[model samples]
Target: MPRPVYLVDFSVYKPPDEMKMNYNQAYTLSRQWKECVDDNHEFISKVFQRSGISPTESYLPPWVNPATCKEPKYDMDSAKKEAEMVMGGAVADLLEKTGTRPDEIDILVTNCSIYCPTPSLCSLLVNKFKFRPETQTYHLGGMGCGNGVMALSLLRDLLQARPNVKALFVPAEIVTYCFYPGLQKDYMVANAIFRMGGAAILLSNQARYYSTAKYELLHNVRAHTGQDDGAYTCMGWGPDKKGVNGVYLRKDVPVQAAKALEVCLRRLAPSIITWGQYAEAARNLFERRVLGWQVPEYIPDFTKCIDHFALHAGGYAVLKGLMAAMRLPTEKMLPSFATLRDYGNTSCSTTWYVLGYMETCQGIGRGETVMQIGMGGGMKAGINVWRALREVKNVHPAWRHVAHAPVTEADLPRPINDPEAAAAAVPAGDIAAAVKASFGADFKATTAVAAH
Candidate 1:
C-alpha cells in the first residue's frame, strides 16, 4: 500500500487593496483598449452586469495602471513580477504557519497555465526561499484552472514514491500576459473575468506531522477529454487575426466542461460512494438497459459521502450548471460562489480559495470529507478527496473581510460603477497591511519592477 499523505497547512494570498479593481476602474481601463468599438463596449457592459463578479472583488497587476500607461506593458519582466507578488506572499504565510524552513521541503511543485518563463517559477521559488540545490522540483504549465487539484494529484504520487518527505505545492496564474488587446468577443471574455490570486500548500507523509495535520489525502482522480477535437479547441491562448495575443473562450466551453466532468465523475464515484449506493445504481442501470423501463441514469448521493464540496470558482454560470447537475443545494455551493464574488476567477487557485472559505467561515468537523472538483482549459477535470483529521475553524487572511457565517444569495451584491459607493461597500480591514507585512521589502521591489 502507498504511504499516507497529510496536509500540514495551506495559505491563500490576499492582494493588496491598492491593486483592487472596481467595476468602474475595470470598465474605464477597457475603454483604453485600442480599436475598442461600440459593440465591444456593449458586450463588456452586459458581461459586467451579469457575470456575477462583484464590484470590489477583482485585482489587476500594477503594470495595467491607467494612471501611468495607457496600453498594457505585458512582457517577461511584468509576468515575473506578478509571479513573485502572489506566490511569494502565499509561501511566506505557509512557512509561518507550518514553521518549516526552505531546505526542509523535499519536493516542490508549481503550476501556472499561461506564463511559462525562463528560470521556471519552481526555480524562482527556490532562489527566493533559499531552498536546497538538491530540492526536487516540477513545474506545470498550460494546464489551466484544473491544475490546483491536478498538482495535488501529482504531489500525492510523489509522496507515495518517496516516503518520509514533505512537499510544497503552489498553484497560481499570471493574468498580466493574458490581457486581450483585440475586439473578438470570445477573446475579450478573459479580460472581463481573469484576476490576480494564488495559494501555497504544504503536504507531508512523515508520521511525525500526521497528528497535527488538518486532513489526510484520501483519493486523487483525473480525467482528460482532449482527444475530441471539440474539447481540444474549446479554450486556447494564441494570437488573433490582428496578431494580438489572448486567451479565447469559445461558446462551446460549457458543453465541453460538462463532458469532461462527466468522464471524471464516472471514475470518482466508485472510489468515494458506498457499496449500497453502488448496488442501487446498478439496479437502476439494469432497469434502463435490460428491463425496458424509462428510468434515468443513476447519480449516487454524493452528499452522503462528502461533507464539504469545494468546486472551482470558474464563474457564476459554471457554478450554477455544476450545482444543478450534481443536485447540490445552495448551501453546498456557497463557498465557490463567495469566492467568485470576492476574487473573480483566479484560475488555478480558485478552488483553494473556496476551500479556505469553508475552513474559515463554515468550519469543517473532524472526520468530515472534502471533495474538491476542478474543471478548466484543455478540457480537463480533476477531483481530490480529503478527510479532515482535525476541526479547522481558524480565520484565514484570504477571507478576512467576509463575516464568519454562511454566505447567502443576499450576500452577493450587484456590480456598481460608482467608485465611492463600491469602496464604501467594502469593509474596512488591515488586509493591505497584512499582505505588505508578508512580503515586506520584496513586495515593494516587485511592484517597482512591474511599474516600468
Candidate 2:
C-alpha cells in the first residue's frame, strides 16, 4: 500500500502595498515599454484593454517611483530582495504553523521559472534557515506555473519512499527580471498580468499528522503537449525584432490550453470519478473505437467527485477556456477569478492562493474533496486531488486580513473584449461552427475535440 501524504499547512506571501498596481497604474507603466515607438504604446494599451485584471492587484520588486511609474531596478541585489520578500515570509509562516524546525526538514524543494541564480533558491533558503547540512535540496527552473503541482507530486513520491520525514515545498516567480521593455505586443502583455507572489507548503507522511492535517493527497496526474508545435510555442521566452529578450505569449494560448487540459482530464477521470461514471466513459470509448459508432464525448461531471476546484489563476482567457472545456459553473471557478483580481496571476504560486480562497471563503467541510488543476508554459496541465482529513477551524495566513465578503461574476470587472462571454455566447453545438468561422476549417477539428 502507498503511504498516505498529508498537507499539514501552507502560506502565501502578501507583497507590500507599495508594490500594488491597478489597471490604470499598469497602463501608465506601459508608456516606458517604448520611449520612442507610438505603435508599441497603442498595442500595449489594446492588450491591457483585453486583459481581465483589475485596478487593485499587487506586484513585487517595487517600482522606483509609483507616481511617475519609473522602471524597477533589475540588478542582482533587487533579485535577492525579491526572493527574501516572498520566500522568507512564506517559509517563516509555514514553519511557525507546523512547529517544525528547519533542521527537521528532510527535503526542501524550490521552483522559480525564470530566475534561477548561481546559488539556487533552495541553497539560499537552507542557509537562511540554518537547516542541517544533510538536508536534501532540489531546485526546479523553466517549468512555468505548473511547477507547483509538479513539486507536490515529487514530494508525494519522496515521502512514500522515506517514512517519518518532513518536506518543504516553495513555489515562486519574480516578474521583475522577465519584465520586457521591448516593442513586441506578445511580450508586453507579461507586464499587464504577471505579478509577485510565492507559497510555502508543508507535507509529511507521519501518521501523527493525519488527525490534524487539513488535507490528504489522493491523486496527481500530469499531461504535456510539448510534442505538438502549437502547444510548444504558445508561451515561451524569445527575442523580439530588436533582439531584446522577453516572454512571448501567443494570442491562441487559450485555445491550445483547452486542448492540453482535455488530454489531462481524460487521464484523470478514471482515477477519481465514481466507478459508474468511469464505466460509462469506458463504454463510450469502446463504442467509438471498437464498435465504430459516432458517439458523443463523455465529460464526467467533476462536481460529483470534488467539492471544490482550485484552478490556476493564469489569466482571464486561460480560466475562461478551462471553464468552457470542463463545463464548470462560475461559482466553482470563483476562487481563480478572485485571485486574479486581487493578486494578478503570481505564476507557480497562483494555485495556492486559489486553494486558500476556497478554504477561507468557500468553506470546505470535512471529507470534502478539492481538485487543483494547473496549466503552465510547457503546454502542460497537472491535476492533484486532495481530500479534507478534518474540518479546518484555523484561518490560513493568506486569508487572515481578507474580508469575509462573498464574490460573484457580477463583482468581477469585465475586460474590454470579454473573451469569456464571447466563448460562452456560442451554443454548445455551435462552438465548432464558431471556431471554424474564426480560425478556418482546418482548425475546426482541434476546437471540436476540446469542446467535447
lDDT of 2 by residue, 373-430 (tens): 8777767778899999988645665666554675567767763125434555443323
Worst-scoring 10-residue span by lDDT in model 2 = 443-452
lDDT of all predictions? 0.77, 0.73
Q: Highest lDDT: which candidate?
A: 1
Error of 2 at 110 (Å): 0.3
Clashes of each: 0, 2
lDDT by residue for model 1 (56-115), tens: 667888776443357777888998999999999999999988889898999999999899
List the pairs of residues colliding in candidate 2.
Answer: 22-55, 23-55
| CA RMSD per model (angstroms) | 10.0, 4.3
Off by over 4 Å in 1: 32-35, 65-69, 414-452
